[model samples]
Target chain A: MERSIRSYSPKDTHKIGRRIGTKAQSGDVLLLVGDLGAGKTTLTQGILWGLGGTEYARSPTFVLVNEYPARLTLYHMDLYRLNSIEEIEDLGLDDYLYGNDLCVVEWADKAPGYFPVNHAVVQLEVIDDQTRRVTVSSETAHLDRLVMAIAGGADE
Target chain B: MSDQDIALAIDTSTRYAVVGVSRDGQSIAELSWRSDRNHSVELVPAIQRTLAQAHVSIEDITVIHIAIGPGAFSALRVGMSTAMAMATGRDIPIITIGTLEIEVHPYLDLGQDVTAIIGAGRTRLYIGTFKREDSLSNGHVYLEDRDKFLENLPVDSIFCGEAVAELRSELIGRLGPDYKIVSAPPPTRSASVMAEIGHAKLKSGDTTDLADIEPIYLRSSQVASAARRWPNTKTE
Candidate 1:
């Protein structure tokens, strides 16, 4: 199933991400594909907030990954600085991708094949200076319920 | 201490990292533990501790045996680089063995076809098939879906490796009672096995060049093709 939500501002994007994050489970992977300045970090910050994280989630483009403690541990990753698939493979992401935690990856398109079989992909497209389109797509039932919750505006 | 050649074996191919020291094909000291994705940090210390336990220093090491992986990429690199550095510093021979080979070595004596598996992220595995009679010729490793690999197992074949525990029920469901899944209760220390193999190879003057060794990372072509089958989610 797939769902698209339009964000009029960064706050709107964060709200949408919060909804998705609240419904995220252990071992859930959220792949974020978008150009720079497309509010990827904004969405992830909202996710961290929803997961009960106190600190802000920063872009992991340089350090590669950041771990945050919350209701469920969150592994935030970024592939923007990686130059090749070999580098990504060497990141040793299997443990985080398959472990008992939640992973949200920015610039995941850099190595699409490296992710697990079951995962949700969130694509952000810039519509204007103040608007963006966020699309979440996945075939698993977990993601289907997540899309439903987002579409229904179920904030609990 | 006797004046025998000492061999150091390191295997950080999976979550379990093992380091062992051997004197003429006999294990003197070995340490294996589950690393919390900190192989780079844990590996060198584990080696030092293992060598200390064996009452041997790094200079006494004459041969190094390392498991070149079809396993975790960074874990394999940690083991590989450490082995390479030690071998180069001592001007000793290094024997590179495949991870799957070490996994299946303990089970080869059963005289049955053995399949060695290493978990590759979610619901996928790195597997290699070994025929008992000609195990060396059939050690080609590849990646496959977990269910797919289990479904294709021949009757009465032995399945072994780190992945066996997680896939136990699936294997029983698919293959019934005819199959055997070997696990670590009677743990076959892989590093010890590597040391023995390295000893045999050293006796025959078979050693890998320090500059030429590389980890055997099986690519994810199968997963890539499966990803392509997903419905196009791109919007205009």
Candidate 2:
């Protein structure tokens, strides 16, 4: 169903994201949803850090996708500026989506029709200047471990 | 000279797939399998079983040959990436050939120009034409649109490839009296042909740098270019 976690600071938010990143595996699709300046990019940076990615996690807003060399390839996509479904399909996203790596998409609400039937969604809300409430949900059991990893620690 | 000097060839350039082993210009084992679109899953196991049947281990492979293709992009990637990994790990030499070249090889010395065509997708074909004389020398395969290629067919050229059968009616309909449409004969032994070519190349020291191997895709993926089209947009 859904699980909620509260982060009092940026570090706490990063820690949670990093935990999920460490636990991520091939064919895992992460849907990040939030408003502007809602710490989405910061959470993604933490995810990349945990994945052993060497490059700085840059916003893929204009480019749509940023690929990083990691223990497993990291495909970070931003659907904020993608206007139409045809444009999104023309990108041939299946090559990266079905690939044997982790795929993280920001502002995924723009292209909901093309999303896989099973995926994990993370919703971030700004409670205050320094606080954020994150909710994670999925239909599959694999998401339980990811949410648990984010709530507890990566070790357990 | 022996099992230690054996070479392995893998081709997933088309729907029909093959894994073969050769030594000193002689094919030791040629394994053919059917795949709809599961190259990634079937390829490794096919290699393992084929090598085992040939009584050769991965350690005995001295060279890895693959078809760096102008075929299906995903299939070509699976073949090239796998071959590169295998060659890199063992420090073995690699020989790269075009997928169309494999189809054109059997008819290379037939004293006629040849155009190899493979199904790219619905209503489109990956067609490459080569002058047999030129193919034997500084090989240059040209990828062109199917309709354009048919309209510009040269006189006395022989057309052949795995997809030739399916396109036979279309070819006959488009061609004139001077052109000859020769559909590729059944029992496609493309993998064997690949191994033979590879062995010949290896003896002549025409191996490819493993780092420089890449698939020849005629159509662009367009993701990067599309993204760059709107750089001034405010996105967060």
Best by lDDT: 1
**Cα-lDDT of candidate 1:** 0.82
Give TM-scores of the second chain, every candidate: 0.89, 0.85
- Identify the CAPRI category of the predicted complex in candidate 1: acceptable
The best candidate in terms of DockQ: 1
The runs of at least 3 residues in candidate 1 whose Cα sits more than 4 Å from the true structure, single-residue gaps closed, are A62-67, A81-84, A110-112, A153-156, B1-3, B135-137, B186-188, B223-236
Worst 10 residues of 1 chain B by lDDT: B226-235
Per residue, candidate 2 scores C-alpha lDDT tens digits across B35-153 of 65799999999999989988988988988889887666677678788999999898889999888878878888888888777766533467667876684535555544466666776
Q: What TM-score against the true fold does each predicted structure earn?
A: 0.87, 0.58
DockQ result, candidate 1: 0.34
Question: Which segments of candidate 2 are over 4 A away from where they belong?
Answer: A1-156, B1-4, B137-140, B176-179, B185-189, B220-236
**Which residue pairs of candidate 1 clash?**
none
Model 1 lDDT per residue over B8-60, tens place: 99998888888999999889999999885799999989999999999999988
**Shift of residue B82 alpha carbon in model 1, Å:** 1.8
